[model samples]
Target: MLFRLALAMGRTLQELRATLTYAEFQEWCLYYQIEPWGEDRADLRAGIVASTIANYAGKLRAEGSDPALPADFMPYLERPEPADPSDDRHLTDDELAAWADAAIFGIPPE
Candidate 1:
C-alpha cells in the first residue's frame, strides 16, 4: 500500500508511515504477506493487513499512478486504504504457511 499511498496521496514513505495508525501500519505489512512483528496480532487483523497490502501492491503495479487520486486520499476518502480481495488471491505456500500458522490452529515458522 505504500506505493498506492504514494500514487493516490502523493505522500513519501515517511509521510505514509506517519499517516497510518499503529494498527493500520501493521495491517499494511501483513497485507503484503510480509512477516508481522509478533504473535500479538490476531488472525483476522493479519489477514486483512496482508490482503490490503497485496491488493494495493497489485493496484500500483497494474494501474500505475491514479490520476483521480486526491492530494490527500485519507482526507478525501475517510479510508483511502483498499480492501484485500483475498477470495481469488494466489498466495505462495510459504506465505500461506505463515498465515496458517498465525491464523490457523498450528503455528509455522515465518
Candidate 2:
C-alpha cells in the first residue's frame, strides 16, 4: 500500500497529476513489477508496502521535512510481523491510507 502511495506520488508528478484511488494504485503496482507475477502473496505484498513506507520516511528525514510522525514510527510500519492475533495492533487500511496521505501531501492524519 505504501509502495502504491509512493508510486501515486510519482504518477502525480510525472503523469496523472491526480491522485489514484486504492484499486487503481494496486493495479499500478502489479503492472510496474519487474516480473509482474505473484502479487497475490500477502506476505510479499505486505513487505513491499512496508518498504515503501520506510523509503518515504527516509526521504522525508533526508530532506529535513518537519517529521510529522515520530522517528520510531517507520520501524513499526516496516516490521514483518503478522497483524492477525497479535498483541501489537497494526494500523488499519484507513490509517495507513492517512499515513500515505501525510507522506504525499504533508498533512497530519486527522
Point out where model 2 deviates above 4 Å: 1-86
> Candidate 2 on 59-99: residue-level lDDT in tens?
74657554333333333334344456756767899999998
lDDT of 1 by residue, 28-90 (tens): 656545543332334445555665666666665746654332223222222326757776778
Q: Give all candidates' CA lDDT scores.
A: 0.54, 0.54
Question: Where does candidate 1 stray beyond 4 Å?
Answer: 26-110
Q: After TM-score superposition, what is the CA distance of residue 101 in candidate 2 from its true location, in Å?
A: 0.6
Q: Any idea how many clashes model 2 has? A: 0
Error of 2 at 72 (Å): 9.8
Candidate 2 lDDT for residue 96: 98
Q: In candidate 1, residue 64 scores what lDDT?
A: 60
Q: Taking the candidates one at a time, how many backbone clashes does each contain?
A: 5, 0
lDDT of 2 at 57: 67
